[model samples]
Target: MTASSVPSSSASPARIPRRKPRAARIGLFGVGYHVYWGQFPGLLDELLAKLAVLERRVAATGATVVNFGMVD
Candidate 1:
């Protein structure tokens, strides 16, 4: 059918309804090799310290943070 043939009301685009925002949940995980801690001094402490900084930053965003500490 030609464009002119269609009704003007039907030709207009449909509007979408706005949705409410949802709360955010953030998950954090880290991994490390067990052997490296023995070989390199302070490696474990360093990693944990970094992760702690990250956790604070993520939490600052007002989202719930679930931090799963490092695993060997």
Candidate 2:
């Protein structure tokens, strides 16, 4: 059959609804010895600071970040 002779449907195309993706939950933790903190003086502070930077980066991704802090 010729293109001009073909029949066309009057109905419009259906559109699928879109949904937002769920946020992710992330947990962060660090480990350090108390003895090392005393020996190194600023070791604990430096480690905590680094952990904070990591937490900020993760949270920026629309995720819930929980920092458990230094573990022993």
lDDT of each: 0.90, 0.91
User: Could you tally the backbone clashes for each prediction?
Assistant: 0, 0
Candidate 1 Cα misplacement greater than 4 A, ranges: 1-21
As a whole number from 0 to 100, the lDDT of residue 24 in candidate 1 is: 84
lDDT per residue (tens digit) for residues 1-53 in model 2: 99877766875788676697677999999998888988898899999999999
For residues 1-72, write the lDDT of model 1, one tens digit per residue: 999887898466886766965568998877899999999999999999999899999999988999999989
Write down the TM-score of every candidate: 0.68, 0.70
Q: In model 1, what are the clashing residue pairs, if there are any?
A: none
Q: After superposition, how far is residue 22 of candidate 1 from its true place, in Å?
A: 2.3
User: What's the residue-level lDDT of 63 in candidate 2?
Assistant: 98
The 10 consecutive residues of candidate 1 with the worst lDDT sum are 14-23
Clashes of 1: 0
Q: How close is candidate 1 to the true structure, as a TM-score?
A: 0.68
